[model samples]
Target: FQISLPSLKERVQDIPVLAKHFVAVFADKTNKAALEITDDYLAALKQYTWPGNIRELKNIIERSVILEEAGKLTTDTLPFEITHTQETGNLSSFDLALVEKQHIKKVLNYTKGNKTETARLLNIGLTTLYRKLEE
Candidate 1:
């Protein structure tokens, strides 16, 4: 007979239980009991969109444990970008043309559409700015 292990997302509710188990295991291995995971910490863990699943969660927990001093785990222990996106729900982008366009617009407005000043403010050559603007 064979049994298959459950995927982390399917077992999301088990995070707290697993965390406690990890605490015990790590404490015993390291001969330390200074770390305690708080309810808020667990809630954040539950809220996170774990794209990389259990392995990612375990790595994060280990990192937090190593960094934390004796006390309850705090939101600070979690990665900043994760927390930021979770809280603010901002759109992430990688469109270079869009970014350049936005920057050019802002600099142009700030300089009252003065091409020379906009170029200076943008730290780019005037010809480059003109080329970008043409596009």
Candidate 2:
């Protein structure tokens, strides 16, 4: 008898449970108890075409847990292919600088105009945040 499990893409409904399980596993292994994940991030994960299947999702969750800070995971923790790719088209020809600027602005807004926290949340340096704001 053989039992077959579906691919990550086919088991999208299971992502949240699987993601939490992976996060807990990685977090305990890494000594980092942070295990927060945003709804948008899970939604993106569900929609993504997982060529690497379960292994891919495991890696993604592990990486996200490893990089997670402030006990929360946002869309920024997602892979570039998942975040930068738009439904309308790819970002190959897109103005990434503008995108960065907009992202900074959004994060800044999210952080309530706190430059230091915004920089931390965006995973950029204080100087870089200042420079981007000036640009």
Candidate 3:
């Protein structure tokens, strides 16, 4: 007798658990700081269409874990498509420049208009920051 399991899209709530599990499994192997997935990250996962199902989600989580800094996982650690899932409706609907602009402004607000701090927080160069803001 075989039991059927749900796809990642069919089990949205499981994202956080699986992501955490993967983080623990990989962080130790890579000797990196343990990653903490933010609420926004989990929400984004739920909103995404899992065409590749759990494998895709797992790969994304692994990438975030590898790229994690100071132990916190921000939406910035994720791909623009995943981070902008809410705005674009689907991957094919992405507007990267618009997304970058909004993210830059949001970060700028967070850093109280400090371009240097905003650039550092966004993991971008100062020139890149200036260029994006100009767009």
Per-residue accuracy of model 2 over 37-76 as CA lDDT, tens digit each? 8888888887777779888889987777776676877776
Cα lDDT of all candidates, in order? 0.72, 0.79, 0.82
Our tally of clashes for model 3 stands at 0
Screening candidate 1 with a backbone cut-off below 3 angstroms (N, C-alpha, C), the clashing residue pairs are: none
Better of 1 and 2 by lDDT: 2
Candidate 1: stretches off by over 4 Å: 1-6, 90-135
Residue 25 of model 3: what lDDT?
Answer: 84
In model 3, how large is the Cα lDDT of residue 94? 62
How far residue 69's Cα lies from its native spot in candidate 2, in Å, is 1.5
Query: Top model by TM-score, which number?
Result: 3
Q: Model 1: what TM-score?
A: 0.56
Task: Residues 1-135, candidate 3: write the lDDT tens digits.
Answer: 999998888888888888889888878887987677788878888888788998898798888887776687777677777877677777777677887797788678667799999999999999999988887
On the 0 to 100 scale, the lDDT of residue 35 in model 3 is 70
